[model samples]
Target: MTAITINFNNVVKLNVDQFYQLCRDNPDVKFERNQLGEIIIMPPTGGETGKCNASMIADFVIWNRQTKLAEVFDSSTCFKLPNGSDRSPDVSWIKLERWNVLKPEQREKFPPIAPDFVLELMSSSDSLSETQAKMQEYVNAGVKLGWLIDRKTRRVEIYRQGQPKEILEFPTSLCGEDILPGFVLDLQIIWN
Candidate 1:
């Protein structure tokens, strides 16, 4: 279940449109791009991971419905990062303004903008090093806040731009802070 990275290094890499087409061609698979132009092929999550992911997405969706300040995206939505990587966070939020500025075509395709907030739920199959690096990449691409939720360890790694990562051990809940005003994620269910 380990994700594999195929480096195109020096050889011609697929452009954004080409990558989108590649994804279209392979309807059953998930694909991602790294800043280095390497392709990351991710396998589907197992049942447990899928259920947990669904719970997390549900929380975000409910909060977004109340606030209407941002748009909520699920894992299936990929973004073209400023650093040139195409990433799909487990759950992501983009400020309404940022999303509004994109052309209709851009909106239809992968939007070329970093999310304001992102969450990475660590499935048992994901490698810690690779996932952590991906979170940092989100910060570099101008994400205001990010969370790496490790259900296995019952810990959360908080990523904020221009700051070091903060780890919370056995946190019962996490407040969205200014990034997601008035929103709070209760972690008790996931911890169990």
Candidate 2:
């Protein structure tokens, strides 16, 4: 995939509630949180987050989605990271148990929580330092697991509680590592 400049000049500004309604009406499109406001309308075409990486990321996410390991959320969210900062991950997951805690009414309003796991796929516009900072922010926010996938290096940086960020390079497997035991993400399949 190639990097394309996103044109936000025509992008519609919407309230969080209106954005939720929009997603409910059009299940095909996804949205992201606005840097200033609480919401941003999802474009009908390619969003930067989508065009940044290859389908391998999608393949891994699709596999998880099919197995119910977790759900995939693109740049269409404004989760409150630690330190009162709000940022959206490239891909994020909510544990079934935590997600189930939400009442049907609560789910109507963005689930009102942070994700259990986050995956940040590196892009041309994002620097390594920026991604690392985002990972630390997620960890500080109490996220259980986080993966910083560097497409340039084809390496994954793993973050967990009380542990150093571990880097795994190619020819190795990306596993749940007790987080979602028995689940394996074969990097070979995606990195191929």
State each model's C-alpha RMSD to the native. Answer: 0.9, 5.9
The C-alpha lDDT values of all candidates are 0.93, 0.64
How far out, in Å, is residue 111 in model 1?
Answer: 0.6
Best by TM-score: 1
Candidate 1 lDDT at 24 equals: 88
Off by more than 4 A, model 2: 1-70, 189-192
Q: lDDT by residue for model 2 over 130-172, one digit each (tens)?
A: 5697688688778888888776687889998778899887636
Winning candidate number (lDDT): 1
lDDT of 1 by residue, 21-135 (tens): 9988998989999998899999889887888889989999998998899899999999999999999999999999989999999999989999999999888899999999999
